[model samples]
Target: MKKKIYIYILVCTFVFRIISPAYISASTVYYDEYVTVSYVSDISGTSFPSTKTSYLWEGEHMVYKFQLSEPTIIKAYFSWSQSDEVPGGIAWFSKDMYGVDIIGNTAAISSKNKYNLILLEPGTYYINYSFGKRGSYKNAYNIGLSIAGQKVNTNTLVSASSWENPNVIRTDFYYEGFLSNLQPSAHYLFSVSSKSYVTIDYLFKQVDNLKADSAKCTLYYRNGRVIKSQKYDTRDTSKNKIAVLLEPGDYYINLSDATAPTSLYVIAEPRTNTLTQSIKRYTNKDVTVWLDSSYDHERALMVSSKVTDSNIRSNTVWKTSRNDTCLVIEEDFFTVSENGWYTVRTEDENENYVMTTINITNIDKVPPTTNIVNNKTYTSKSITIRFDDDVSGVKSAKLNGKVINYGKVVKAKGKYKLVITDQAGNAKTVVFTKK
Candidate 1:
């Protein structure tokens, strides 16, 4: 009975050890506001960093909990006053209090490795830091946290005040930011009120001897959908420019650098509709229209027309022009020689289009014909004259060089001069005798 009781006591002890929570030596620190650090531990001897924003403690491990409202890039910098007084440390990002490491040890902290740039999605996150081993000389280490893109307002739309004049390409709508080993990217938010062709121009220059290997810019819809993205080497001439057609909506621009610190100047300019006149009319002359030279690239121009009793073939022309390049379409360039309705449309590779209609009218060489109601060679009553024009409509009529209504009767019984004109300036004169 004594042996059985002892075994039962050992079994109960094992079960209690399994059921109880494990010991956690790390203390948790919560940061609710920008650059405000709050400590929750009762340890009295703990000290803080020189810069009140950083955490300085001699503990072997520490955990920081912070909430991010939007996707952000953060920089975590770890340092110590004396390199020999502290051992190396490691920091990682996790989603929960003790969740699986999302980014493990990419932020290894040592005297040589002082900082790490972390891109994080919106959520509550934990920064778990572990000083590899306490050094012989018990000294406090420091961990500083900062937001890389803090200068940008993630929720607010960049002011469109400078975009008031959409016709002119304006660089006033721009964001200037610095990138470094600590902060390698910047984010910006903007809105487009209408469908437009937008141009993004950037001036990226090296701030240090460490030249960036590559630079990239990505455009995203307000809903987190990627609209377009471009990446370029720093040496590429086209690396500084991006042009795209965007629909009306909100968007995000993320500019990133790789391997070096850079100074960035980004501009977003929305090009408005250039075709002001939708319809143009010309009579007895050649039709000519100038293409918008704002976009200095090649585009497809389609011309379609149906002329009366003519088999005119429609054609598409590719026009390439630049600031220094001139492309001229000669006079009377329409394929149709007769009068008809023509449409000229210009389209880009993205299928964005602008169009104009041309109404061409040939010369009406034939004058208006007149019909006399009283055909008698000698008439004692008044006579009525009716006028009609085929091509151009009848404009006006005059009797004896004085304005008179068309198809009106004349009561005077004497020789009279009747004149009629058409819309195309074709005039007709008649001599009649009303006796």
Candidate 2:
């Protein structure tokens, strides 16, 4: 019997050794990972009510500490029971050194609170948790911890800013998922991608309720590098629209309106360019063209038809419904002088401008060359355009102010022809002489 007892004790010891603890390791953290919110407590019972305990509230804020070895990109996410009552909000973060919020509202989860952390350097960080500006904090909330890409069982904590008498943690009660910080009529999310340009689209509201008075947007890059800005006023609540020019890299965008409305939604898409900028063509006659302009100003084009006001006719041969980086300059017949100068004026909406001048006598004075070979007929409404050479800065072709797809039939004639423009706004059009 004593021998049997000894063998049983040995077996118990082996079982204990094989089973690991519920909590994972203490050290050995990886880079670029995601963490979620795990534990939450409402101390004040005001903003974070017990009724919303099991589910995450949009107003509840939490903080967490983590160590980093090197600069890393951290993407954060959240897991919770999806409930019908919770409205969505934004997530934010701050470095551990300073208490200031360096990156404000980096990501917004209007429908889902999941977010990606803004890029951070190697060191310790204490993330700021809030449901936006909607409600106040009533108690303490906890966020889940993950390092180097592994989720571990560790304690997350939230405390009042001060522990003195009348120590208030701003803990308040709230319904599940209510984004208290999001303004009813002015709420928006601004995302500036690696390539500085910003794209904003509406979200989370009816089509008509979202409208802006000025349609003006601004972007901040490399810690306050201001770029180009523009203004527009329209009721078109479409999918996505580009805002303005910015330097290439990460940035922040802000959209605002003078007149307040109801609910507003906005998002930013990364700036991308598939074409390069260059000079497209030069008129044999005297004419100067403005190439590309920096984000701060508008490119200009000046033409000296040298025709009398009575004889010279002016028209917008080509204008883009969508903004184009490169365009071609085109004008109808203009009598030129042997030693006269034709100029193109490039000016932005802001009234900033530049000018380019060409001397008429310089070139072998000749009109833009063309070829009518392998002539194709228009079965459907279409027009054909042939270029002399691979024109510089003529990245795209447009007809009647609308961008035309390459190899697609353009259904227009005469004044409505294939117009090309350079980045400098030097433009040209190949008028279709109807057969």
Candidate 3:
């Protein structure tokens, strides 16, 4: 009887050793390093949220880390497959591995889903999850986590200056994660090197029974002062926009109170100096008028008889070219059929004027006249000749096809040929004999 009992005890001890190793290995299947949880869209229906998942078996655990740049209210979600027999799982938020729980532990029970809304400050945090040893069979458990609130740190910087292209920044604001009780907001930062005109354009899309009145945007100074603010309704389209002139400084823009996702575009255009000058040109030809400034599609060249007169024609070709290093010139072509003084002006959307005067006249066609007559006898030792041009003045005079000073005295000893030409390329010739 003692020998039989000894054999049974040895067999039981061997079985216990084998089973203990498997239990230790299963309990130690935890992640040594924490996985970072970044925001990712996993939205459905009217909820705009991001989700991250981790898997664990019975008696195993996992940890995830996330950082917040600003104070935000976030929703934490822990869920698993509904088909599997309900496994006992618990999750909690903490500042570190050994820190006390910021939000008390939440259990995943027969419901298969658990969520909590907690406001967190700007800092790094960790979420720890564990599957307790309740079920005898090993089963995989999926844990889902998410956060939602003001995403102010995700800002786009805008530089609005003449040298750079018009700055346009765009973004989409949506409710993040699975939390529907809290709305999402976005923030943007921009700087104007000088005074500029800024336009804010946005499109609001209703999410599952949400109205447009739930959306709004505000512009603020760097010092937290409000500059301009507007709300949107169902009728608010991209065409409905806000325009404001901002001084040289940094500014902030915020969009909030949105029940649905919204798309927004902010355009900042720098102010330009007006160019005022005059040009004298001949009619029946095309003349190019240019200014050293940036190009804008909204600016158009306008033509009229007087500065104050209503514009008669605005059909002019405008083009932009670079003439020197960092110098841009905007040029417009103007043509006239008759002679007159026409005002050519261009105005930006902000009503800033750039204007010039064009004095047009017909080309000189009449030739110069002279006192010398053809086949006339002149016996004097020296003769004085005079030249006159009515329209364009006399350009030059020639004697015997050789250019000479005009109004100069000449010797009248033999047959002489004289020629005169005007500034308009008109010429006249005369032949005379001296006896």
* Candidate 2 lDDT tens digits, 1-435: 111110111123343233211101111112222233322221111111111122223444344455544323344443334432234344445553121333434445433334443334335665533442334333223333222221211111211111121111111111111011121112221334343333443222221222344555444453555553434345454532445533334444334442221222233233332211122234334433333333433433335433233322233411323324224343312234343455444444544333334444433333323332222334445554553333223445565568855455545443445565543344556544433
| Model 1 regions more than 4 Å off | 1-89, 92-106, 109-128, 131-171, 176-197, 202-216, 220-227, 232-240, 245-355, 360-366, 373-382, 389-393, 400-402, 410-416, 432-435
Top candidate by TM-score: 1
Candidate 3 whole-model C-alpha lDDT, 0 to 1? 0.52
Superposition-based RMSD of candidate 2 using all C-alpha atoms, in angstroms: 25.3
Per-model C-alpha lDDT, please? Answer: 0.49, 0.34, 0.52
Better of 1 and 2 by TM-score: 1
- After superposition, the stretches of candidate 2 with alpha carbons farther than 4 Å from their true spots are 1-217, 220-333, 345-355, 363-435
| Candidate rank order under TM-score | 1, 3, 2
Residue-wise C-alpha lDDT for candidate 3, range 1-435, written one tens digit per residue: 111110101124453243222222223223334344334332222222336565666755455566775544444555566464444555556665421333433434334445443445457776655565623336766655454343322222321111133223432232221111222455666677765677777655543333457667778887889998887656637545778867678776666665344456667676544433333432223444444344353454534345543332322222223211111233444344444565545556666445455555545556788888877988888778888987667778988778777677877478778888877677888888777
RMSD of candidate 3 to true structure, Å: 16.0
Candidate 3: Cα lDDT at 417: 87
TM-score, predicted candidate 3 vs. hidden true structure? 0.39
lDDT of 3 at 62: 53
Q: Cα RMSD (Å) between model 1 and the true structure? A: 12.0
Tens-digit per-residue lDDT, 247-347, candidate 1: 67766666676423223333444433232222243233344443443443334343434222121122223232432121233421334444555554445
